[model samples]
Target: MIAVRHIGPPRLTAGLEGAGRLDWDAHRRLHPEPAPLTCEGLVALAEEGRLHGRGGAAFPFARKVRAVAGSAARRRGRAVVVVNGTEGEPGSAKDKVLLRRAPHLVLDGAALAATALGAGEIVLGVADEGSAASLESAVAERGLAARARVVRLPERFITGEGGALVRGINGRRPIPPGRKVRAATRGVGGRPTLLSNAETYAQLAVLAGLGPRRYAGVGTPAEPGTVLLTVTGSARFPAVVETPAGAPLGHLLDLCGARAGEGVLVGGYHGAWITGEAAVRAGVSRAGLAAAGGTLGAGIVMPLGRGTCPLGECARVARYLAAESAGQCGPCRLGLPDIAGALAALAEGRDTGAAADTVRRAVRMAAGRGACSHPDGTGRFVLSALEVFAADVARHAAEGGCGRPVRGVLPAETAARLRLEVDWSRCDGHGLCADILRGLVRMDEYNYPVIPDEPIPARLEGDARRAVAACPGLALRLVPRS
Candidate 1:
């Protein structure tokens, strides 16, 4: 089970915070606070504290508010506030803990942002059942159900993206659209929407309650505030930690009972790998992580045990990321699978002739080609694996195996099984299915359709439906694997 560990004197996780999850009444007694601030006041406070988005992007919170306010000023309708709590990153669980333990605090922040941005409605999108239930109950207990609502989201990774969450809430497919559209300018219901992760909102609540000076008391001058980190995989406690922003990485690892020389994956699956004792010296802040050739993506710090095969672990996560693609763009759909295939061959250490080189080339081809940055993020992840695990790669190349079993320190989900079924009797060989979903259906020599033996992953369902709709004879259909 996951545990809660606080470091460097808790701020966001103040009184009534501990190992046990806090309920509504208990939370109310601990911190029943309010901050009545105008849009300018909120922006001023954020700018003073240098509040940054707790999500992977690390965008400035004040700039986001200004953008949303400016965008809403042009539109005739009101603005929208969305608290993104999807937490799709496999190794990250900090947002889930906040939503479960301190629902009221999150709502307070959302309500504050909503008032500042002229938004009458607050929408919270959650993936897990426990978070959803707790938030809904909190909204009702605080008598906020009228203006606040909870939306259940699909478990796919892409659904957690900002634009994708807006699309899902607006009743569209929860995939990043094929073009660039800033959610702050034009968002849900054609109005500007202020969207940020759950931790961002919780931090906002803290900043709102304690002004800028007190909020700046915990962290460094550059990043002055406490940040949440989900510490898992080889840590003795495997807990969600709240630590001061500039705390030494070594101290946090030691607190979690991690050894000094272990290989660490900071920032989740999409983050880079830092090896050996050097990982200990890096700071926990975004700027500090960047100096160490890593990121603070979603604040996930995963340590690989010595016994685990790093190559096999990388391959597993690569395959999982490949299957998580939204399947709308060619680079993410085609290139990720190519990278995954090459990594699988490398993991097996069998006939890996040019497979390593192929993996390197695939990463280059995949980067910066998708509508979303999933491809770019995946490329970075795999490229770092190669750099940090160079010795492992050489050993596997020479010996045809590492001889170490994959411990699956990184979590992955099996792709759902689906297949394209063709009714030959009804098929007129229109080739429409091939045109709509070339990845799943291709034209054969006889001008009929050809399908692969493997199953179509869940991410490809939208394309599958479009292909079925485009079929002239209604011959193309998708069926679950038997």
Candidate 2:
């Protein structure tokens, strides 16, 4: 039986009360007696504590701070700080929780970072209105109106990316552009910027309070500090957890009431799949997870329930991610949907080899081909599913059916509502739609249009319109978004 533990303080737990709030001082106290912010000092403290980004990249805080400091000193330009509260990865709720419950902690971290980097301004960007309001109110209450500003951003999945957030702050659409743009070099009105996740800032606040030695005392030597994780899937308690880095995944699974038999999806929808609870023995640190061919992406640990078919779940998630694509890059815009469709075909037990081939080709084609890591992340997700669930693929291949329904394990309201209808009576098998919409609408071995699971992009507007116009059978019509 799975065991569950109701852990951590409640979301609205009082600010910095007792041991839990050791790092946080009341806004009034902190504001009135603001400490000097220094780059060398903060770097020494962070390096001593061995602080890392909690956003799952696990990039060293000292390195990132030093980069900004070095650049600022060289260029003779002031630095700017951005606290990213746009927790776009659906399953990761830790940042939102921190902003809502301990806004001051996040602010403190940002202030320390701003002072360290010699930043003139600090901006906190939030995805939801509630988080924005919470941060805004906290800033006002703390009398930090001059130092910090909170901006509410549209809640698109990719908008949470550092560069995208920077663009949105500069009055551009939240969509990622076609080229690479690092927020550190040019960001927030073309100033050098330091951006990190909200939880990262909070942890920095903790480091500031406890110093490096005290902070490193809790977690592993390699990655010393506590990390907040949002545990979901079949776990009984799906609350945000604050545990030491390098904690065993098994311990986390045990806390979440996860059963042993089912595979676990670490890192949320765009994360990897580990085959059993035994795989949970892998360390939760970034390097540790990466060594296991998985990542602690956004600190989301979702356990796939036993009853659900893993392949089906993967297809659903692939479809959702495809839809969420920024639609800028050619391969991601074209390839991901094909991959999703191929997975769907395999799930339905139709032309299994062909579907697998399509997925393989799409994965190869889409990897690292986007302005953001969305395609690469989604490709990793799909490839990990194939690796971890080899038996499921074989079963589908042999039986031409899985004997299980495709239960929606992935949370995508938009993709769930999208239906690709085939009017067999109208489909003359002319295959023109398949020809024109090559990436999205492909031909199955049997000559039917295999619509891959992804959002139709505006770039495909001309092609889709052409395909609809030229369909000899008049069987294809693009469905309007509801």
Candidate 3:
């Protein structure tokens, strides 16, 4: 299970003293609910506190509110509020922890936003069944069964994208459409929608309770808030911790028990890697990470500890990320796999100089050319790996091996292998598994199972299990490759 805790003094996580999920009564007893605020008041407070989204994009929260309101006015329709708790990145679990431990906190924010937006409904899209169940119970406790409904989204890397989440709520394929579709202007049920991740809403709840001045007291002047981060990897300390925005990254590294081996991957797979020294000089906020040549995308910090092959680890994640492509955009379809293959060649000491050049070129070709921002984020991740691990690349170029085995310190689809199989004895030509496991399993001329010999990528594990459960014939099975 994911551990939940806080560093320094906890503000956003003040109510999380207990390990189990806090019920509404216990939640209100520990953290009293805030007095309701008007839309103008809420927007003004967000602006004054400079509250930005905790999602990877870090968009201004106030702007999102105004955009939704303005779109509603123009279109003559009511607004919709969406709380995205997918947290599809394997390295990130802060949202999940918040939902599991502090569902009321998130609901408070969503309820506040709904009241301000004049919206009739709230759609909470979650990554797993547990979070969905917790939220469903919380909604019932609040007597908001009519206003709020929880949906368990298909677990996938790109499923967390705003447009994609909206699609899933609309009962469409949960993938980013092959073009831009702003949720603020036209979203759920074809109405203006305000969409943001779970942490952003929780931050809003804290801001509403504390008001502007008190909310701005702890963090930096421009960025005032305590951000929740999923800190894990070779450090061996895996927990979701709440920290002030501009807190020193080195202090956190030591607090989290980092071995300080190679470097840290900030912002999960879509974020860049920073050198150990860079991390030491940096803070946990966006500007600080940017100064240190990294971005605080999605609030994830992962340190590469001693004895693991950093180059090999990067290549493994690169391949997993490549496998996460939605395949709707050309850059994601072609460039990602090419970049992954080139990085693997460099890691395997096949042709380091040429492979490095190929990775660089592929990254450029992929970024800014996707249907969504997935390609751009992947480019940032791969490019940062090349820059931070330059010495390792040079060494691997000179020698055939780095002499250290890849410990799989970083979490990704390649961490393990899973197989998809079908039992012919109970087999019927149902073809349900084939439809769900799209790119992996297929049906042939007779419309029966034609399972591939390839291993299931960990990113697709949820879909694999769903396929097994959905099989009418009960012939499908997914097992770990032994």
Q: Which is the leading candidate under TM-score?
A: 2
lDDT of 1 by residue, 353-379 (tens): 676898999898888889898988888
Candidate 1 regions off by >4 Å? 15-20, 260-262, 415-456, 460-482
Backbone clashes in each candidate structure, one number apiece?
A: 0, 1, 0
Where does the lowest 10-residue lDDT sum fall in candidate 2?
Answer: 1-10
lDDT of 3: 0.84
Predicted structure with the largest lDDT when compared to the true one: 3
The positional error of residue 174 in candidate 1, measured at the CA in angstroms, is 0.6
Off by over 4 Å in 3: 414-482
Q: Estimate every model's Cα lDDT from 0 to 1.
A: 0.83, 0.75, 0.84
Deviation of model 1 at 281, angstroms: 0.9
Answer with 1 or 2, whichever has the higher TM-score: 2
**What lDDT tens digits, residue by residue, belong to model 2 across residues 36-140?**
557889888878887778785768888888888777777789999999999888777778877875788788789888987879999999988868877888888
